[model samples]
Target: MGSEAKGLALSAVDPRAAAAGLTPGLPLAEARGQVPGLVSLQADPAGDRAALTRLASWCGRYSPWTAPDGEHDQEGAAGAMIDASGCAHLFGGEAAMLADLVARLERLGFTARAAMAETPGAAWAVARFATTAATPWRIVPPGALRRALAPLPPAALRIGAAEAETLHRLGLRSIGELETIPTAALAARLGRGVARRLDQALGRLEDPIDPLRHRTPLEVRRGFGEPIGRREDLAAAIESLAAALCRRLEESGEGARRLMLVLHRVDGTLQEVTLGTSRATRDPAHLKRLFAERLDGLDPGFGVEIMTLAARAAESLTARQTGFMRERDRTVDLSGLPELVDRLESRLGAGMVTRPRACESYLPERAVAAAPPFVTAYPAAFAKGPPRPLRLLDRPQPIEATALLPDYPPVQYRWRRLLHRVSKADGPERIAPEWWREIAAGATARDYFRIESEEGRRSWLFRAQGRWYLHGAFA
Candidate 1:
């Protein structure tokens, strides 16, 4: 038996329990007396709330705006709300979308009933009470909200239970009956709730829904009369969406960094494909290339009926000069390098392509680090520093060396079991140990040199603590 502080009561019940005359909050002892061999389990309100949040997120395929309905504490949630205003046309129509939403939830082992109206209050009321064979899921058409809500009880107007009972005793059984009474008379008795709820449901007052996710501003969607299943047709749809998105970006002077594609299948499933660019781009051709790498992975199960393209992240893009001078046009521009890097990263994972960035550290390995390729901003270190080696060692290798003087360049050195006699050498360039490092107390300053061996092979070597180390090789 499920136990609580109130003493062995049912916290929740299923259809079978309800059919057997067992209801929630019923004493377990009485439940067992009424129906022999009754069983119960502990309730998990927190887990239920968490599941509701996830379900709200998954509802984004229908609308970007979805919020959990009803106030919740430790008791769990009531339900969820989806704002399918502009989204319904994509799934065929308002009635079709409502039916599809309920059917899909039922397939996922959930009992769901959905209603769409111009007002949230009317939708909520119609969803709970309005039952008709012609419309499986309720949909109150515009200008017909009052007629649709006339049959529902005053309790369906979201009034308090006690208030509903009081109104019922006063013979105000239906919303239409309540509407006939004057506002002042109803407020004198029912305390303004009846009038407020009636006004909210009949579109006399505004009702706003707070969404769980942020809605992207740059989104374009297209719906088809018939479902499309061909790969070439999907490609054409994507290309068309990219072009439309570029036009929108151009009007706003913004470019996309990350983009997402949502394909709504006829079978009520959603297939998503996402791609990112190395640089903010408004070029439709470039955007197509990035999405092309992952387009093959999409499965248009039962055909796709609607497709949406959205820019998830964007940045300001300034206009660039397209027409080049005759003489200057001969010089090749490296501005297109970012596109190349984006293509490589898209084809072979983002980690595969990286750039070397200079860090604020004295140690050779710590001084330079590998980072993602930069497109918009370039580091100041590359512009002001002296020339570095073409290739640097992961860590400096120790070597045996002899120098002409104590603090001078190395005259000769042996590295990796090979001896090299220095024919020419440059003066020592000193680098101090970083004061913040833990090893700074015992660390000595490094004196670096550019040395050319007898074979004219140039190398960068540094000396610290009376030991020589090969740091890099010059090309």
Candidate 2:
């Protein structure tokens, strides 16, 4: 939402693009080089998926069948597929609900393409792959698959890369060609992927896209003193709330994957914060630390009256076993999260603790987000990824300088009216967004290096366009 875009892919919209000349899979560099003035950003899959999940949850406000689509398979951000059939009248009609959803997303800066159909697979294909000028999103009558997908690309078939490639090599680029090929020969050569894709496209195969909901038990609360304006006051309120909340979770025989704190302000506005743990825990102290790091947003101008805390997305609770020969730890039963959340809210604010969520997008910055206190835990582990700063600049700031090599640290650098000399340095971890990411081609590559100043202080460093900028701090 800043210099870098927020949701959707940067590749989705490039400012330099003329008449939207951009094509899928085109190198971001070449695309940007074509449009020198393109402004772009990295998308956040985490935020996107979280928003989608919330939408699915909010769908209950409309119809129980509403579900989100396209999210991280892990961490409960897996988006969903919904069935909005004869239930259209539930919201006055399908068109009205669709309009309402679009309006809701638009208010949140989301542009969506929605379609309704008899089958989940067909609906999904139409929602994303359908061209506006061709078959718009709608419920086609029975026996309409041939008319719906005959002209579309192979992707609408939901086939894998290898089969799609084979079809492309044979000049069978559209679904129509594959349809014309004998099913027997196609199955003989390309095997099940091609056959299954064809079957899915034609609605002969049943395809199910499940809505992601954490199986964990949950508890929620709506507080009367919503904002709790002062930081300390908010923290105090949170403790008792957390304890009460934990007691609810304990009764269910499951541990929460996340915890959400919703502050329905006196003004009817909603502010949320979330927290997560490395392990399933109701440890109050640990939650306080996590929340303390992020509680600056709760201004508590008037006062918060309604606070709702819900914990969903769960797993069966298990006591931790200590040494190989030892039994489970006895103290593991302590659900300290309430006490910790209490201290943190009082110290930080009413709505401060949060946990990171995984989003399903190819964009870098859009891959993770601080979920509201609802999601109770973080990824057990992340794959090898770009080096992240212990402290990251709220936004990337351009620097003034030249670089023979984006390494060896600059001899001198200036920031916020201070100048410093470099003394030591470590590597250049190159991070690049996907080709289809909606980011500027010129800024696609970031070389993050660890640098030490003459004062013997280590800092996170990065160079863009041969200019050096200090990005973060390191202990």
Candidate 3:
């Protein structure tokens, strides 16, 4: 790697040796010896990836469908791909988005190149190889990919190293040279991924994006000027925006399921906070209260000048059209759901906190799991079964024991350290395994046991394959 890697060990003279001339896969010692003035230090991949993820998250303001492209971040590489198909216009059009993206990256002290195209391949090539100033971050103009990628070597298409070496040997260095070659030969040598990438970049094939952001009903946002210097000023601005957005919802008889507030500082940094409600709601007071909980965290280091409020996962707002006579008179309180989700999500990460979900497996361990994170938008479920356990272990632990009634609780048990004596015991609740999903299809049956020890400690235990383990304690 080069001195541009920030901490990669270099010759202590020139900081751009690797970025300037040395190639990847070359020994750093050799690279340093060759480039006399190289200055470098060791690079941290973890830090680079984390920094890129943060930048990618910040880029979510422009397009929620953005995702980090690669896992490795040794040096000279770190970026995200934004799926801008349906999101470009939301940012005041593509040209504005490009300018904003560039300006934001510059403020963050990053060298960035943004490109817009009909396909990811085209956008990737343009962003990686084209002249730094392409317009419209989401819309790909005709022939733009061709003009943008022609000068770069065929390796820009991300073809394998061997194929690049072959191209170099055959005097076909630029992408234009490889493009002129017959497709059959390239396909025979490089396999399908290469030809596909080339065709996709040239816009000759249909390449649909699997967006990072799933399709939701709507998550609309509105921004305001006049820096909100005080909490009251920011709150007032938010209430006004919420009221305006609620008007749009009221017209369609709909309401927001979740609301997000984004405060963009004058220094190009962004602070975003989200609130979820139990039921669909448009109450400005409730919304103000929710945002107020996390308001202090939104520090405006350079003074926030732009405030954006977005309403997400909209639901039909039920209203008493005629208090005494209306079909929608009995409205389901959806606001409560978001309120709980917001509170729990605030303490734990959106992924860590989730609702119990009924899983479709007979194995007790596989019968339940957490719902997808931050998604309060699942449709109703109709699966019904016996009451599930209030307490379940993430994984079952093995125990040594001896049973008395063959189908009763363990008379003596041993696990981890000490042995236990079961003075009282309950019958076994027979449970079966999901043999169909078994890797080798030889799983045994399980029997649940609820036991009370002489010490008055009650435990809900289970036995499988001649083993007894305490799964949960009745407190």
Q: Judged by lDDT, which candidate is best?
A: 1
Which model, 2 or 3, shows the larger lDDT? 3
lDDT of 2 by residue, 305-414 (tens): 55555664556776543221335545444345445554565466555766566776443456566655543344443345655557666666666543455454566667
Q: Model 3: what TM-score?
A: 0.60
lDDT of 3 at 434: 68
lDDT, residue 31, candidate 1: 92
Regions of model 2 farther than 4 Å from truth? 1-20, 43-48, 55-60, 65-67, 71-80, 131-136, 214-475
lDDT: which is higher, 1 or 2?
A: 1
TM-score of each: 0.70, 0.41, 0.60
Candidate scoring better on TM-score of 1 and 3:
1
Model 3 per-residue lDDT tens digits across residues 1-475: 4354544443222225545676655566676678776555665667766776777667666765677765322235557878776776877888787878887787777767777876777777666656443332334586676876778877677556677787798898788888887899878877776788789778788766554556443444444455556877777777776777677777777778777777777666678777766557777666766666676776867567566676767878653222222455565443355556555665554555655666777776776678743343443442665434557666776778887566767887776777778898775777777666664677677788777777877767887777666676665
Quick one: best TM-score, which candidate? 1
lDDT of 1 by residue, 146-179 (tens): 8998888987787766788998899888999989
